[model samples]
Target: SSVSVVICSGDSVFLEGAYQYSAGTYFDTLTGGNNCDSIITTILTFASSDSSLTAASICFGDSMLLQGAYQTTAGSYVDSFSNAGGCDSVVTTNLTVSSQLSVQLSSDTTIVTGGSVVLVASGGASYLWSTGDTGSSVTVSPTSTTTYWVNVSDSLGCLGTGQVTVTVLPAEYLVYVPNVLSLSSVNLEHTRLYVYGRGVESLELIIYDRWGKKVYESSDASATTRSDGQCCAYGIGWDGTYKETGKPLNSAVFVYKLTGLFSNGKEFIESGNITLIK
Candidate 1:
């Protein structure tokens, strides 16, 4: 009685099983209980470290580790696993090295009064503003409304751009003239007289004798006005004289009137009489 051994594919064997030849390698004892026979064969197969390893979904500019029995290498990466059995799988993962950069304006509002803004890039890089300015931030004082933009570039030569808007308002003020009045004179030594009005943009003065005869006329006159305090009256002064002669005329009663133009293009008139003692 001798011992026998058998070995199966992917399985080990020892001298314990009953003597028999099977579909796998076998060892036996026979031939007058003194001879022995043996056989051996090798089987090759393959398997992954993890069959459940899968692909990952992520946002742009993000990195993820590909977990698998096999180590990942640098190259173009593509997901080869198909949607089988209602589950996602990863067959291989490839990697590509890139110097990626992106730019974003500090403010989304294009119209801003006055201030500085920041232009940032995903990858730290150099920045250039629209006005030939270079820096991560730019302080701009635009005289008028303007559009500003930034150009950014990474060390790897990737480029990105962004823009913002700025607006400037105009300065203004209000102009005012209070009250304007006219006075008349009669019996004056001279037929003509002139008076200025307060805040009077343009003024015209005319004088008439008792018979309604035009005696004196003046387009230019001296005028003054009081801008502050109550009980203050604005007035104009005129010398009694005829335009034809420097000599004073005989004393008489005369009617005088005034007309004025305002900044707003409105006209005003005043009439009265004065007596001259000559």
Candidate 2:
């Protein structure tokens, strides 16, 4: 028996010639297990393989594989290969690598002149900061307005920098006292008594004689004889008199003490001398 068929180019079924395969109709003859003659016909088809594409993204120092080779650089590549289906294949590869470097830092901040603040830095592999800190965050207290810088590095050896500023304001709890007093002797208008401080919550003024006896003491909710610019727009003082006696205190050198609480709830203490002159 005979068979006929149309085969494409470059294909064959017989082990006949130097060509691996060619498009043609072929026949094979073999003896079966029963020693009987068996005839078989085969048809083959072949065509050029299509061009292929591959993409890649690799880390800094890693290699990009293209064209059956490891390439350290990034670029377009092409390679020819023989497909298992007996076709010539052309592959086109476009590769990319990760080499970007970036860093982030927290924004500017303001704090009380004596307060502290925390600085935040990004997730860099390593860091160096101007405040001598090497961690991702640090605590700082700047006496005045200060700017801090940080140097950061990634695993790929790329470096980036970030900066932040901290501003310091004047303290709210400020205290001031005069060194001398006329003790109501200069004039009736000069007898105004007050203790001067800023942002004070409550105040206590105590006067002591030479023997440490508490001769005069005034307390919270002090009255502002005149605005001497104390906390709460109020003032604190004693009227040159004794606490135990209604008589005016003698004109002499006397010790005075001032104790108060700041607006932020901190304690304040101060002591000084005032010369009570006639």
Candidate 3:
């Protein structure tokens, strides 16, 4: 009697026979049997392991998650992965750590008329000003000129500081004259002079002839006001004649003086000599 054996695909089979079987292909016959049988065995399977994953780059205060997603400050992070074979795969991810915040003045330089100054924070999530301002920006109206400082913080509680200097100048009044007096050639007849000044309460214009005789005088003159909410103490129009009589004065050297009274009880005086030419 004879027994036959057959092996299916993808199955491994081993047979003991008198003939030798090499590692490659094999065909063998059972002892004392006329029938022949074949045995086939599948090769060992080797799969490539998954490539190690890591975060490309991360900024300060950032956290990387297991699925490669990033978050801020704090979050769950996976440093390694454990495979079914109990082998742990390395996950080289970096956790950015830094302590930095940015602060800036809203208007680094400003020109205000005794008003409030605004300050702001940049690249920061929270703000803390030395002047007790907690918002992103704060307005500081100091009684006097001062240098202010601000401290800023980020979501990670990092802090930074910035400073600004404010200048408060004293109020000033300026005076301007269209033309300077020329003593050598004085056209007292058709000469019109314009005077400009600020915060003036009164103006006194007096003109004296070469003989030291008062030729013209306008005391407490009616001065025109300027558009800057300030009054201008100015006197215009001078005819080439004497105030005492409508008679032409002799062409000679003359002296003119201007006195201005300001609202603050301050006084300003200016004088010049001019020559009258016929």
Candidate 4:
């Protein structure tokens, strides 16, 4: 009589008072009830075992199932399952967890009308701004206070977002005065000390030296609209010189008083110090 049996690798099956491990045929001799020798044939085979290795990744704050367990960190893991022959079907997992996505903008800021501000975003592989811009930095000139948003993505497709508010200063009797003047530069605009502003229908500018004596004064009411439609009062700027003579003035600090009237007939006044550098 012949019999067949299957077992797993590294395991044995008992047959005819002996253990069988490898796939082969064996012969056993046993005595029958009639006292005659009986021959027994045993066929042994090995069952199929399974092993696999896999690599997986998950975003931060996310989980993945492996070996009937949830993993959230980066590392290697192993699991075992029983096959039909009760063998260990081993599975190895090499998992990697990505870092959390974070995005930061430059700052929420304020800018004068007709002026532009640069907004920057960091800690991202790609960026998309609300202005339909796709760069990490964008320039915006909003007519009014506005909020801008940016969407960022990492190489792993992880997403993050950031926003900034830009406050646009309203039109008023505004003026810009320079504190320093450079005479060495060839640029005429550099040497000329000009007070720039908007909404001024009439302007009076006076400059005084260290002494109380006034060195220059202007009542020029000439105003022109800039290309951007903002009014700029030209009013004959000073050229680092005395009004009496066309000679240049020495390097020193000078005090100035500026008074004006807006187009709406509102009064405006300001005083500041200026340094003339030769």
Best by the TM-score measure: 4
Badly placed stretches (over 4 Å) of model 1 are: 1-194, 221-237
Error of 1 at 10 (Å): 99
Give the alpha carbon lDDT tens digit for every residue of 178-267 in model 2.
667675455643453566656667878787898899887776544343343434324535567777465787788888887877677766
Q: After superposition, how far is residue 43 of candidate 1 from its true place, in Å?
A: 99
lDDT of 2: 0.69
- Mark the 10 consecutive residues where model 4 has the least summed lDDT: 224-233
Better candidate number, 2 or 4, judged by TM-score: 4
| lDDT by residue for model 1 (1-278), tens | 22233332233334224433233343443345456443333222222222333343332354556443232334434343434332334455445445445576664322123434444333347888888878777767676667788888777555767877654333221111222212233433122233423334566667777888776676653433333332222233344555435556456777877677645565555566766544
Q: What is the TM-score of each candidate against the true structure?
A: 0.26, 0.35, 0.31, 0.53
Indicate the worst ten consecutive residues by lDDT in candidate 2: 225-234
When 1 and 4 are scored with TM-score, the better candidate is 4
| Per-candidate alpha-carbon RMSD to the true structure | 24.8, 18.7, 19.6, 11.0
Q: Distance from true position, residue 45, model 3, in Å?
A: 30
Model 3 C-alpha lDDT versus the unseen true structure:
0.56
Q: Which ten residues in a row have the lowest lDDT in candidate 3?
A: 42-51
Tens digits of per-residue lDDT for model 4 on 131-214? 999999999999988999999999888788999988775576466567887878676666767677766677788999989678
Best by lDDT: 4
Query: Distance from true position, residue 248, model 4, in Å?
Result: 25
Count of clashes, each model = 17, 5, 4, 0
